[model samples]
Target: PVHAARLTYEAMRVGAPARRLAKSLQPLAGRCDARLVYAYADHASALAADSGPRLLQVADEMEQIGALRYATEAAAYAADAFAREGRQDSARQAAARCRALNARGHGAVLPAMSELDNNAVMLTPRESQLVQLASQGLSNADIAERLVLSVRTVESHLYRAMQKLGVSDHHKL
Candidate 1:
């Protein structure tokens, strides 16, 4: 019941929530109760509506974790898939699940899911902050204002972050 409610809420947005849920939870198919199975289906439907390709990847992961019934295995599969695909939408969804499963409630399913690879040159704290904001799609002017730095400074930070990450633009980050 609790899981159903949670799945419903998650499916409330972007439609086809159930599809994503289904694919993501496929590995737990027989292990989960009817309520959870329904919730998983609903979530997969939701994912399908928002991003079909991503849901496909989620389904792939679910298949990999086969009958494990462990959140860590689920998250590990997600993180690994996200790393391989570099899909922001899927990574975000997987990250959310990892965080949720790590919470005090929710059975504390996954304690140490593998961390996503961060294979880039290091950034200073300020540069890291700027990169974070940039990844969120904030404009240079907006980021500068928020950080109380000049636009030129913000641009410089962005430039440095991109260089360190071995990328030519912000989108790669």
Candidate 2:
């Protein structure tokens, strides 16, 4: 059942609608493994959020057939929903649960590093300078002043640098 749910989720990821699947599973919601049902319901809800409104129905079914893992994942999902809705307090509460679950499962807060290609460079000299200053926690304006360039020019260089490094944000650099 878990395998089936995972396959179904993958199908949904590849553009298959989950509403019909969710409806079909309604009869087995209680009889099926609760953990599998929870995962299925999560995928259904995510798909519905983007594809349609049937996810709410799936969520209702999930509530009727609950499990501990589902509750944990639901907290994380709720945090994301609240964050999207601009409800900071509710989001934080939910995010805290996610962090707790992550800690319990992995026993560490940081991602493991890979040693492969650890020392490589693809940035130009000016781009390297932008990233270096950014790593030191300098603001764009400060970096610009230090480099004797206009703030907008610094921003352009940083943008290009991040692009070349395949990162989207300064924090990633």
Candidate 3:
């Protein structure tokens, strides 16, 4: 549910009062979505703290923890918030950051569950490149440096490639 959660509050904007949502939001107080909800509310429903800056901070923290999906989500929200707040420069920067992370395969779109479930597995260009480099005995860090990707991203691509290729060993590739 967390993975699929969105940051919109359209229903709230035209419908319920803030107090009405308080009870429902209580359970999510310490969760990541709480910040998303409240930050969104802060922009529209007269809550506290500015969302643009806060969401960017949250995005950075999530990225540091390797929660790329969450980071991308937060940055996208931040960009929207900044744009709404008349902070055009910050909005563009946040949008660019969101795109960069989303390009790392952490966008809102979920992968097709049946993609890897098929008998025939196809390698994406990035996956194929990572696999080839790994087969050449390059460390993940080395590949990351050459490819301008994070080490974790390199490792993730290789892991997915290994699964698709039906190989348990990187050395055997």
| Backbone clash count for every predicted candidate, in the order shown | 20, 0, 0
Query: After superposing candidate 1, which stretches have Cα over 4 Å from the reference?
Result: 1-120
Write one digit per residue (lDDT tens) for candidate 3, span 1-173: 22222323333334445444434444443365545544443333232233778767766766776767656666666766666786666766776676677668544442311122121244678897898799899999999999999999998998987765556787865
TM-score of 3: 0.38
Root-mean-square deviation (CA) per prediction: 12.8, 10.9, 14.0
| Deviating ranges (above 4 Å) for candidate 2 | 10-21, 27-35, 42-73, 107-173
How does each model score on TM-score? 0.33, 0.39, 0.38
Collision pairs in model 3: none
CA lDDT of every candidate: 0.52, 0.54, 0.59
Give the number of the best model, judged by TM-score.
2
On lDDT, the stronger of 2 and 3 is 3
What would the per-residue lDDT of candidate 1 be over residues 30-147, giving only the tens digit for each residue? 4556544543454354344544344434444444444233333344445445545556555545544544444423443333242422311335788778888998999999998987
Clash count (model 3, backbone only) = 0
Worst 10 residues of 2 by lDDT: 111-120
Please report how far candidate 1 places residue 142 from its true position, in Å: 0.4
